[model samples]
Target: MSGSRNPRTAVVTGASTGIGEEYARKLAERGYALVLVARRAEAIERLAAELSERHGIDARTLPADLTDDADLAQVEERLSADGTGDDAPIDLLINNAGRGEGGTFTKMDPDTIDAMLSLNVRAVLRLARAVLPAQIARREAGEHGAPLGVINVASVAGELTVNPHGSVYGGSKKFVTLWSESVALEVAKHGVHVTVVLPGYVRTDMTRDVQDKGLPDFAWIPKERIVRDSLRAWAGGRTKVVPGAQYKAADNLLRVIPRSVFKSVARRFG
Candidate 1:
């Protein structure tokens, strides 16, 4: 994470827990060196050690908040090289560092909204931009045309009509989903693959709290299955993979329904 590693390295943000942790583990299983990043240094370092012991792969823990410009620059610098040298290109980048905040828009704290948007949207795109030039360069060199996969973890809320309490969170994820799709098309011919993973209520510490507060059953999904399905989709070159059958069905429905009617149904269901 701090220092550069092999060109086959995979950088996974928010790698301390949830789906990000699963992605790190699975990628290690597939023999990729990892740059595991998260706010908590100890947790990510422990995970790195565990992964190294189990898979014999290199795992570096970079403890930095993605919202910080300095921290983001550290990552960007490690992934970039001068025009004279092409040494450390990130083969896979997983932009999985984001959060969800719920409440009425007017009642929400302005600072919280700003921070959420900064981390969820700004950091996601900036990180992608920092690494893309190197990826494109590698593709142009015809170096195996080895796959460069970028997985953006969006949300089921991105595909649904706005929920009163989840409006801002939903809007941010919708940005991720749309931006990923457009960028995937831009990079596909260059041998770079991009996927936006729209997960539906994955069971993490975050969802546990939401459920404890009595959110509806339709809103909770198992995290393991989400990870499994997403890893499969990422490996198979899928541009967008929505986890869970219910979420898939719901997405398909939202596709055809009128926005006004969909909004009404979503409010009642949520």
Candidate 2:
């Protein structure tokens, strides 16, 4: 169900499915006009129409593979455009496009590694850079929300010694987590927020295929809860958010563990 109409808008990458889809749903529920980005044009357009019809809000689809340089640039350009001038300024950006590749850092295919970096890291930074100027400008103009923000859908793997299975993936997310925190501080004085959400095992199509990657049934949380918890933390001014109580504890544990020990543990059990 939709909430009262809001003049604000949001751009959500990877909005066709999984956590990204949930973000689209929840943001639409709160009345934000949406720009949904994903690789499948038909899929995203259908989602857009459903959201628009359900919520009485604008929902447009921009289909692009985040790994393609040209495609990535288009998404950024659209964000910059929607973030300024007459249309409802893009009040939120959910940088949720990512690739979860299987295999250890060493055994991973080079092409897959490259694709992961392009989508999981480069696209996120480029898109954020494009939209932030406008988001900050609007907030400084005494916008009621004060700070327009970007939510980077990072992973719990970012903070762990997640090798063997997800080393490169974890490394890329580590970049996202740190980058969000750094930019979050840089924009804090201007009331612009940046949140990096580290979610644990979430039951999405991606995870279903990677069930043997050490995620247990008990640890798996539904996709909806992850998105909901993340939005709450972001809106409540948190710079970093871990959605699950179990993952929250794990994140804390990783904080004090030494790199050597982490590596040892990863090799033996993970």
Candidate 3:
């Protein structure tokens, strides 16, 4: 167990693959009984089974397309119920399910952009909204530890809305990053911690094509590193995490650049 008072139940979205799967595995090792959510039932089930076998933790797989309001409602319902004993609470919630569609702004279809933002931004915001109150309540009652936390997996693309073919994707992640920071401030008095994981590029299937597309050296980061760094950052209740060193420096640079210069620089990546 991470700590005597730490949460035992952790709910992770997008557990079918990549960072989400890694979060599920590591959380189980730390003694969390996981509720794994993903659109693909078989993948989440297999992952849940493997985690259970390896860690001796209870893991439930829920196939949920968060883009669907109905599916998100089911997750909210599960979180509201303390399936565990009253003393144990839903310790952690990892909102990691997101997708992207790439093209020039003019070339991007409206429906595709809507779907991307819906999954990447709206769904995450809604899920966080659904769970935060319970977490705050548990904290106020002195039932959870230092920070009953939520980690929203944003991207470094949010830091500099500059990537070619990533206008909508970048905007969506920026929205996630901004909202998470605001929520962190709003909920700290209640002891509910919120962290944003802003990764650059990782070796997930989602970025396989980006690798082939001749990514800059800064954007090249391995998935294992992302997983390790994110776990460490979330545990620390960091407001934001930039996994890659190069990307971290780039993120720092974006903070000081003038808007006009930044917009022009953004066009290069686009």
Tens digits of lDDT, candidate 1, 227-266: 7787778767789998878889988888988888876886
- Candidate 2 structure quality by residue, lDDT tens digits, 185-268: 998788788999988888777776667667667788778878888888888888998887888888887887788997888778
Q: Give TM-scores for every candidate, taking all chains together and pairing residue i with residue i.
A: 0.89, 0.91, 0.91
The candidate that wins on lDDT is: 2
lDDT of 2: 0.83
Query: Candidate 3 residues 121-223, lDDT tens each?
Result: 8888888887788777666655644457789999887776566437888888989999999999998787778889888777787877777988677567776
Supply the global lDDT for candidate 1: 0.81
Candidate 1 residue 1 Cα shift, in angstroms, is 24
Cα lDDT, all candidates: 0.81, 0.83, 0.81
Clashing pairs in 3: 164-269, 164-270
Q: Between prediction 1 and prediction 2, which has the larger TM-score?
A: 2
* Model 1 lDDT at residue 14: 92
